[model samples]
Each structure stands twice: as C-alpha cells, then as structure tokens.
Target: MTEMTRRDAPAAIRAIGHVSTLCGVVAAALIFVSVLITCQMIFLRAVLGQSTVWQTEAVIYMMIGATLLGLPYVQKLRGHVGVDLVPGLLPAGARKALALAVLSATIVMIGLMLFYGWEMFHLAWERNWRSETVWGVKLWIPYLAVPLGFALFALQLVADLWAVATGHDDADPNVAPEDRRH
Candidate 1:
C-alpha cells in the first residue's frame, strides 16, 4: 500500500485508538473508585474518628495511573494543547517535519521513563518495598503503572509520528469530537 494509504488504514489506526480507548476506560474506572474511597475516608474521619492509612496512598496511585493511562486517550482525542502558532507560518512539509520531531522526542522521553521505571520496579521487588501503611500494599505494584503507561504512550506516539512524517491523517474522527479533532 502507498504510504498515505497505509497511514490512513482504518484497521491500523483503529487498533491504536482502541488501546487509547481501553486505557481511558481504565482511567475512568479508577477515578470513580478514587471518588468512592475519598468519600469513605471523609465519612470515617468525621464519624468513626479513624480512616484507613492506605486510603491516601491508594488515591494518589490511582490518580497517577489515571493520568498516565489516560494520556493516549487524550492524544487520540486531540485534546492536547499545542502551540501550532509558529508551525502555522511554515509550509505543510515543514510543519509535518516539526511534528515528526516532536513525536521522536516524545518517544525518547517515554522510552527513558519505561527503562528507568523497569529498573525501579526491579529494585522495589528485590527490596520488597512496602508502603508505610496498615495495609502495606506492595509499592512496586503501583509503580508498575508507570512503565505500562509509558509503553502504551510510546506506541501511540510512534503512530502519530508515522502519520505526520508520511503526510497521512488516518486518525479516527469518531474517537474525538469533530470540533476537537483539528
């Protein structure tokens, strides 16, 4: 297939979008759980004079997971704010080159995150790190979310870079609101 056609390929683009959508759903669920936990913490503190020590940490981890996990979805939704002001002045080719550069930089950054996160995960596991809380949930488990999210984000960024470099815009329109997909 031609480069343009390949970039716009529905199946390929949708596959990437599906990952983003799935992550978004996970993020949403985590947010909901976090809300419930917050409510529980509030009620217990007010009425029972006690709250689970792990609640705050759990919320923090969940929020982190939600943010990282939701990144690809936000990218899919074209919700990221970009200063295209300067690019607008350039020719289409130059603009796309800039996009490619941005995507490449993103991949490198995420790759580093994934690599260091893996190292951290290994260290945490080796040391059997536990949160300083009653529940003592394994710290490593929550930290794994970092690498997982980075991996998925890297994949999405590659897809985006591929599209930009090839001058293909095969992104799904339905994934994001029409007005927002620009």
Candidate 2:
C-alpha cells in the first residue's frame, strides 16, 4: 500500500482526541460544579442552617461521569499510571501479540458495556426512574455516562486496534512501559 499520509495516520486518533478534549471540558465542568456545590452547602449551612439534599447526589454523579468518561482520554494521553510487568519479559512478536490481545480485550469489554449500557439506559428511560434524593432527578441523569463514555472508549480502542493491526514498529501504545521511560 501507499506510505500512509499525515491525514491517514492520525485521522481517527485526532477525532478521538477532540472527543477526549470535549470530555476533559465536561470533566472540568463537573469538578467545578462539585466544588461550587460544596461551597454552597457550607455557606448555606452557615447562613440558613441547612443545605440542599440533591446537591450532594448531583455532585457525586457528576464526578463519576467525569472520572469514567475521562479514563479513555487519560489512556490516550499516557497520563494513567501503570507498571511494565508484561513487556519486561516478552519478545517482539510476542509483545505484538500481547498488544493485539490487549486491544481485542478492550474492544470486547467496551462492546459488552455498550450493549448492556443501552439496555440499562432504556430500562431507566422506560420506567422513568428517579434519583434517590430530595429532588426527583431522573435515573438516566447519571446513567448517560455509561453509553456515552463507553462509545467514546470504543472509538479510541478502534484507533488503538488500527495502529496495532497496521504492524507499525513505532506507534502509540505499542512501546512497552519500560521502553517509554528509557
């Protein structure tokens, strides 16, 4: 095949990156909301002798969304921590195989999550389930993260799979943990 062009090499990955940047925005917003709510609660308790009940739950769910949705982005950026336990001992082809296996497992896991997440969101939507707080927030409020996050995760996984399948000697996520630091 033709030598991969600049656009070819980074298309899906850049798209995933844009989406991850969006997730980063959302995560920052969620964290900001959490901080605001905490401060609000403290101010309210100081002034009015009580705070809103739903704010606590709202902040918690937002944090969860932020964290899980940001995971794939973190993975993409090499921000997440890990140890080089596997690649330390494996050979080249064996390392490639392990990389494929890793990508495949991620695909399967994300696929399963997307499948079950759809069902869960559907059930919540159909039943009009409510949150467990003073406010009657819909259950799907927090549930949105599952499908959205997993779908984005699946996209990133595909990018990873493509890089691996292309047999690139040097690619993202291909370098073992040890090779990275050295």
Candidate 3:
C-alpha cells in the first residue's frame, strides 16, 4: 500500500477497529474481575467456612463472555496463531493473493457463526431460557455475546481484506513480526 492510501483508508474501517479494541479491553477487565471474584469465593468457602453460590457460575459466564468478546480485537491485532512459512516463501503478489484467500475464508466462517449465533440468542430470548444452575442466569444474556462477537470479528476481517487489497496493510498477513526476519 502506498503511504497515501494508508493515510486515506476509510474512516469507517478505522472506527470499527477502534470499537473492537475497546470491546477487547472490556473483555480483559471482565476476566480480571472474574478472577478476583473467584478468589473471594475461595476465601469465603475455605477461610470462613461459608457456602459459595453464584461465584462459580458468574465466573464461568464471565470467562466465556470474555473469550467471545475478544475475538474482534484479536483479529484486529493479527494476534491469532497461524503458520506463515508458505506465505513468507511466496512472492509479494502471491502473498497478497494468499492473504486475500485466507481472509475470505475467515470472513465466510465468521459470517456463518454470526448468523447461527444470532439465531441461538434469539431462541434463548424468545423462550426465556435460564441456566439450570442455582444462579439461573438468563441464557440470552450470555448468548448475546456470541453473535455480537462474531459480527465484530467478521467486520474486522472485512477491514483487513480491504487493507490488504489497498496496500494499507503491507505486512504479510500470515507472518508474525518475530518470524518475518527468518
């Protein structure tokens, strides 16, 4: 990508990435809070000889939410694990093509997830589903994250494909920085 195009990539795409980053930060915070709560639960159970009820269920839900909500941010940062040896050996044109192909496949998979996730969320909402646990938390609340996360991930993937096609993303999509020198 030309320096000019890099500077000129659509503001919308940049905005989406920024939102994804914010969501990721929130996910991290949720995980941190979950850990703290779990510790508290342990203390109450072991140290104080008190019964713990909601903590375990809450922690599990938070962790699941965190994982789902972090997807877009991970994609935005290119943090997902991938093998890059083949792309590294290929010429620039071939590399770009491969990147596009991989991104396209990712988009398709995420898109499908988004669709099915939404369906799941809707079903839970409509049926007033609740967990079987004593906490009995609404299932739709957590299910909501599934579609939302996949949708954001799909959007991020589209932005990445656009960046690659426009030369805004000059680095090989498949290769990590540390591995690039090899």
Top model number, lDDT: 3
lDDT of each: 0.77, 0.73, 0.84
Model 2: how far is 156 from its true place, Å? 0.8
lDDT of 2 by residue, 83-120 (tens): 55775577767777777787799799889989898789
1-182 in candidate 1: lDDT tens per residue?
23445556567666887898899999999999999999999998998998577789899999999998888888776677877578657765666667677778889988999899888888888999998878898988988888888888888787777655554553321122232324
After superposition, candidate 2 runs with Cα above 4 Å error: 1-8, 167-182
Return the TM-score for each candidate structure.
0.85, 0.82, 0.90
Candidate 1: C-alpha lDDT:
0.77
Rank candidates, TM-score, best first: 3, 1, 2
Q: Lowest-scoring 10 consecutive residues by lDDT in candidate 1?
A: 172-181
Q: Note the residue pairs that clash in candidate 2.
A: none
- On residues 1-182, what C-alpha lDDT tens digit does candidate 3 reach at each position? 23454467788767887988998998999999999999999999989999987899889889998998999898877789988799878877898899999999989998899999999999999999999988888999989989988888898889888888776664544434454322
Q: What is the lDDT of residue 19 in candidate 2?
A: 84
For candidate 2, the per-residue lDDT at 145 reads 89
